[model samples]
Target: MGYNHEYQLALANTEAYWADQADRISWFKKPTKTLTKTDFGTYSWYADGELNSAYLALDYHVENGRGEQVALYYDSPAAGKKEAITYNQLLDRVARFAGALKAQGIEKGDTVLIYMPMIPEAAVAMLACARLGAIHSVVFGGFAPAEMAIRIDDANPKMILTASCGIEFDKTIAYKPLVDKAIDLAEHKPEHTIVFQRAMVKAEMNRDGDLDWIEVQEGVDPAPCTPVKGSDPLYILYTSGTTGQPKGIVRDNGGHAVALSYALNNVYGMHPGDVWWGASDIGWVVGHSFIVYGPLMGGCSAIFFEGKPIKTPDAGTFWRVIEEYKVNSMFCAPTAFRAIRKEDPEGALSHKYDLNSLKWVLVAGEKLDSSTYHWLSDLLKVPVIDHWWQTETGWPMTAPMMGWDNPSEARLGSTNKPIPGYDIRVLDGDGNEVEDGEAGNICVKLPMPPGVAWSIWNNNDRYVSSYLEAFPGYYHTGDGGFKDDDGYIYITGRTDDVINVSGHRLSTGEMEEVVSAHPAVAECAVIGVNDELKGQLPVGLIVLKAGEQIEEEQLQTELVKMVREQVGALACFRSAIVVQRLPKTRSGKILRAILRKIAAKEQYKMPSTIDDASILPEIEALIEARGAI
Candidate 1:
């Protein structure tokens, strides 16, 4: 079926359409009621169904004669390791770990917090929690103790699973001390902490509840998959909130399984034996959906990578993995490619390996700029699709359906049309629809499709006020963008990213598109800074390509001219600052919010998710040297 036909069918009869999609997965107790409205004014999918996510991801595939198939290819240049785990092998580890958890008093519906690095064991720990019908919350390894404490208080898990340390390039960050500090700071502490000891570092076992991972599972019997209601919570992923506190977004079992299965087959065009690599950390939603669950559930080999895009020995690591594992489809953030491009401007490193096996490259987590998009497309000669979604939505909200007979054409700055089951609309502040090609608040008309977070964990009221209250009868995406006349959707960054110059509203994303087009520019971020007369003005922070040198004054002149020519002088984009690096989250999203805080000289708290906090001071110094706009 074509994209239009499938999309129309979904919108026409959401229940019937989803019910058919639900049948694609192996449900223990198949649901007759597909979609149902709750008292909280939200919808739930497959509410009456029963299934085990871990079962569908592991045992079912093994039962169907895929036992020997490699389910995960663990590649970690940072740690100097490589291992391929088959379905049978992974299932064994998962079941044994589930038994270990069961022995430690973990039961169905209980939550277990997992803080580990990008390793095969991280996948095992998550699957083990799912196998016991327990909800797992994964905090990115190396997060600050205060941040970890906040999550610990929110989830209030019965146990915490962590590794001894996490390796970043040549640095070995001890995880035990951080975990210990968080436990001390948190009001509610777990009963026990299971520590996975790696050879790189050994954690102190002085804590009362500390338990060794291998010792605990030595003689434990493998645990069987426990049945769970479709509406039962699968995981709680915390996304940073504007109010300093983080919101724990909840994902359910049945809908999550069904949506991901459908997405893998249709959205990404993955086959049973294909190698799928999502080069993102397991702490994020992308890793939870694609790197582990989606690929394993769809019978594909997932690459569990623990390395950087540029410096875990150069920009060629990605290509090496693609060639080594014969990866068919890969997914990551656009920042990764920009880093690779900045390091290897001529694409010299990529030529060393065979990347012909890569069919599709999908990027998300942030907007994909036109220059980076073109660079990747030209380098790979494959479909470089920029899909859009958030932590709330587990899968793509907008993407090109590669499985369709006639998918929409890939646009430069657009993320293509809305995926099936998402009724996307561009609306103004008053909640009225906007004209085609006019920028407005992007929203999805309710009820939102499955795989979306049904509610914020332990805070239903907050969920409503945060998403639904902004616009009645629609889920406010918190993003600003427009739909083209041809129906392709372009995301203009977060709604807050829209800056007002005097009275005219302009998207910094659009200005960023103009600035990044310069040949000397590799990656850039345009943020709104305080302006007494104009309300807010846009400023660009640029990182030049490797071996490219231009005087700061000359580069600034060129960028200002480019923005004026492309976005008009009304954009008020006069300032351009050259910086060695931009502060970003570990997930690779440029910390524009923090930059705004710095530019305005407002007091701001250090973000726990920042990849390098030291970069913030460097950025502040550079901005100070440039004087006021």
Candidate 2:
């Protein structure tokens, strides 16, 4: 069936449509009810179903006679290692790890925080958590101790799983020190810390609860899959909040399995034994959904890459992997392609490898500019699909479904039409639907599709206030965009304080918190400015205290160091300009929107509510002098 027919059918009979999709996965106990309302008044999918996510991803495939097929191809250029793990082999490791966790008192319903790099063990730890029906929260290995501490306090995991170090380009960052520091800072203490030691760095097991990863499973038998209700959370992935605190996004097992399976077959058109590569870090939602759970559950071989797109060793690395593994489809952020494009403008490096095996190239995590979209399409000679979704959704909300008999044509700067289950609409400030071609708040009508986050971890009120309260009956996306007359959706960046920097969603408020903490700064506003490679980069505009005296150069250096030390290097907050004063409204709210426009060199009118109109030119002059753009 075509996109229109399938999408209409889903909306016409939401329950029946999803019920059909749920049948694609093996369930321990099949669900009779499809969609139901929870105590929080939000909708949940497959509430009566019982399933084990790890079983669907591993054991199910093995039981179906695909045990010998390669499930994960471990390619780590950073460590100079390569290996292929079959379904049976991966299942054995996961079961043993689960057994280890069980031996350490990590039973069902307990939370486990996994802090590791882009290695196969990271995937193993995550799947192992699922095997025991534990909720795993994977923090990006690049985050600072302070950032990790916040999550540690929030999630309050029973145990922490981490590697000794993470390699970034040429530098090997020891993670044990960071984890140690985070645990010291956090109020809640985990019962145990399982350390996965790499050859590059060996963590000193000095802590009272430290345990070796391999040693813990030595005497334990492999554990079996633990059955769980469909409403049971499989994992808690945190996303940056405008409040400078991260919000945990909960994904349920049954909906997550069904949605990803549907997305793999319909969105990307993958089959069993097909090689799929999601060139993203496991910490992000794309990694959780595509890199680990999605492909494995779909019975496809997934490449667990541990390297960058340009370096480690060249711009041709992605092409080489695709050629070597014969990857049928690959997904990554537009920022990666931008980096490769900058290094190899002619796409000469891509031609060195046989990329004919790569049928589709998908880009998400941030807006795909028209230039990058066209550049990739022309170079790859394939459908370069740009889709849009968030960590909360767990799967693509909109995309050009390649599996559809009559897929929508690719549109420049558009993420294409909504997927079958998403009823996406553009709304005005007053919560009314906006006309086509007019930029407005993008939202989804109520009873959001399966796989969408049901509630914030431990804070249902925050979830309701953050998402539902704004639009009464819709799930506010926090993104600004407009739908074209042809039904294609164009995402025009975030509508809130959060910004997407190189596919990583970070909060400007969080950066401001770090910047304002500097002694020389009285107040500061961090705005995301447009960039050629990173999509958006954080630029800090600061106002000094009345008697404080410091050179702009010195303050900039100090602020940069402070932000890096506090937020993490992934923030990319290098630019800081000292301003005499900040433009604010009469109500005392800083005019950040004006600052962003000024930094982008875009035209803007002075707001009538501005407390001081002349501050705009002064801010613009300072930003220009600093070359922050």
Candidate 3:
């Protein structure tokens, strides 16, 4: 059957279809009911099943006699480290760590805080939590003591797992000092602080509450995986904290396993022994799902890369890793490709490596412009799949389900169609379904699939108000996009990203798309600033390709004319500033809100997730210069 047949079947009987999908995993106690709606306006999946996420990810492969196969390929160019751990070795480490955690009074439902860089121990810590049935909350290593303190206060973890230092670009930051400061700032302090010496940065440890990480595991023995109810939470991953306080997104054991298992095999078209690399930081949801858990549980080797796309060596870092590992499929952000293209305009770096091993390229996190998509696709001669999902949804909600029988051609700039278990729709202001080409709020129909979050930590009412209340029974995605004729989705940025110029709502994504199509422009971001006359007007920030330069006045004129021709003059697009780089979060999301705040001269708090805090002053100076012009 084709896409239509499978989609229709899923739509007709979603519960039964999802039930069949759950059968792909090994459940200790099989579930009788697939889905049940709670009174609080959320759905629970695989309620009666019993299983362990760690066992599925580690033990199953070793038990099947694939002991010698590599499970994690550790490469950290910044830290000057490289190693490979097989499935059997990984299982031994995980079980030993679980036993150590158990010795420290960690029970099944306890919480553990993990604050470390993209190291193998980070994955080991997460899996140890899973093996012992504890809920692990991993804070990004770059976060400040204040930011880390907030999550610490919320999760109230019994233990904090961190390393001596984190390697970022050319600097090594000691993590123990930050952990100590956060513990002081937090209302609740963790009982124990486990410090691993990665950088040998000479970190101070509290004699009473701190323990050396190596000491804890010296005499520990491997422990058996602990089974949990299907509804038991696997982990709580916090949002990147772009807006208000971050919401703790909870993913359960059984549903998460089932959904991701199906996604890894069916959606991405991978099987056992395939090498899938998700080039993302482990702090984010993508890393947790695809990089560590999803691929491992799907019976494939997941690459844990500890390096950046450009600064690690050159623009060739990604290709080198792929060639070195023979990576079958890979995932990265659009920003990464933009940076690489900016550095290597001739694509000479890509020519050096034999990228024939790559089957496809998967991109998410932001809208993938048609220009960048074509640029990469033309070079690799492989299909580029741009999928869309969020921190709340644990897996891909909409992606090109490349079939085993008859695959569909990937439509450029479209985020494919809704995946099997999601009933996605675009709705108008009044909550009615919009026309095919009209942009509206993107929402998922009620009783969201299993892999979705249970609630926003302990704030159920906030979860209801934040997602459910906005669209009634639908889960409001806070995104504004339109569906094409063939059911493909064209995401037009977030709902707040829409600018009203003279009462005409225009998407920054549309303007950015036009600007990116410029031959000289490698990447661009568009935002609306206070126009005083038109309510708001679009201003573009353009980053040119390497070794390509044009007169500033001429560039602005061409971009203004292009926006007028494409989006019409009501866009009032006039200012286009050439910048060295756009300010973005660590996860590579452009800080448009920060840009808009700077343009309007309004007081705005700097987000802790910003990749480079120095970029903010640079943006301010650029805006001031543009205002003078």
Candidate 4:
């Protein structure tokens, strides 16, 4: 039950391994070349391949007679609706949208920006772009006009797709006005704007360029799939940059399809006709891989959930959806489990559903603490797979690839072993391999897997300098961790997230793990704050379980003692304070950098992705009360 054979085979000859994966997808011209390298730190996989991403994801399944099976299950409690679309139906919608785009003068290689909610139209728009061999860039729906403008200026999309309104909780937020503002702000205005009229709110449309979505698709025929080279760009997903500009991470057509198709069977244990649900938004990389392309490539069902994890109803929302849809496997962030645990500590709401159909629950986005991992695993009686990857790398780099014949046991804190085709290493600052117990930078030897990003859009220099130049022949992950003697990788924290106390490096993740182990603590975040004496100190911001109470002095003492006993005195973990909630992005990633800024009383820019901007003031108040500000 070890992955030694698979891992060894892939690393021995990556070209052979990736070539076999490429064969899994249907192609017009099968690739004769596996990978091509350049002197400027760039690579192209399946160079001579000719295939359309949408054709493989949609047409292949329908031609194989699996069209009757469900392909998209959309449930939006906030919109007060629920529906499912079969493979045939999904294909028709995507094709019509593709035809509409073509009719508007969009051609292969053209870029389109899609900004919509968690509705099925978002997925359709992405597929439509792929079907016509056009690149699609999807921006998160909650983004403001200013934020949208920044992306529009960067990509200069030919067309923009959006909806009239998006429902969050019970409120209907208009999106058209924001699109119009972004168009006005951008130096390059899109030629056409297609609007999906939900009728939830009144929206003004510009007569010169705006077109109703329904009218555009009224009499158009489905466009034929365009066969592009394997290296053709599929999408551009932007990630936050340190220099106040976004990094446009580009995914190619052939390699992405091949890698994801391989993962459907190997990483997810998925087959045709099965249901897979990934409760992530289409704007992010996770949604691009899992919620849309991955499941569709496997000819399986994927859910598009349009509701908050907690406030949409209760912590029971996920369980109810599972029972209703009979979901086979589910994927969500670790913060979700923390929220569910906060609401129902004793499994009161979870026990109501029959999760027997749920074989696996995967957690990502952030490190899954040992306490939450064990709590939810025991409740569901299923393997809680903690996988690790980034936006640049489309799919998981480390995971416990489960199987019916040989099941893998859950390793509480580890993200299990590195997946095949990924040669993971822990290296020191000088690029030397570290001992098993020592923490260092996590890196991957070049060339990376097929699914890994080939380059940053329009910025080959940045791609080389950002990932390659840091460590000569390695892709610096920007994360710090260690590999155990048994080959299990434990991600300690981001290298930037490490706290330097009197020149001793202390991982905030390790400190957070110790503090979160306290029985009364529901969740906690550890941050490093500058100090005149120690240089930096670890501060714990805790959120206790519902109705749980303890004296502030006594609780702080307990938390300090826990860290001292576990991580030693060098941790400098003296302060602990309570907070009602932590600031997070809509994707459930904690805003630790913001917390660190508040702790050190340093100026910080407010991110537009924050779920609740109001909670930021609360954190500031708590910091001020503790004299840390």
Q: Which candidate number maximizes lDDT?
A: 1
Clash pairs for candidate 4: none
- Give lDDT tens digits, candidate 3, residues 1-629: 47788887888998998999888898888899899886788988998899999999999889898789899999998888889999999999999989999988988999999999999999999999999999999888989999999999999899999999998888888998999989999999899999988754867876568998889887777778999988899998988444579888889998999988888987889888989899998899998999899989988888899988987988999999999999999999999999998999777899999998999999999889988988998989998989999999988888887535665567776788888778899999889999998889999888777799968777778789889888898999988899998888878888989999999999999999999998899898898888777888888888899998698789999999998999898888999988888889999989988888887788888798899888878878987887921
The predicted structure with the larger TM-score, 2 or 4, is 4
lDDT of each: 0.93, 0.87, 0.88, 0.89
Alpha-carbon TM-score of each model against the true structure: 0.99, 0.82, 0.98, 0.98
Residue-level lDDT of model 1, residues 298-378, one tens digit each, is 999999999998888999999999999999999999999999999999788999999999998999987888889889999
Please list the residue runs of candidate 1 whose C-alpha ends up more than 4 Å from where it truly belongs after superposition.
Answer: none
Compared with the true structure, model 3 gives a TM-score of 0.98
Please give the TM-score that candidate 1 achieves against the real structure. Answer: 0.99
lDDT of 2 by residue, 286-404 (tens): 89999999999999999999988878899899999999999999998876776576567778898788989988899887556555676788999998998998889989999988887
Ranked candidates (lDDT, high to low): 1, 4, 3, 2
Using TM-score as the measure, which candidate wins? 1
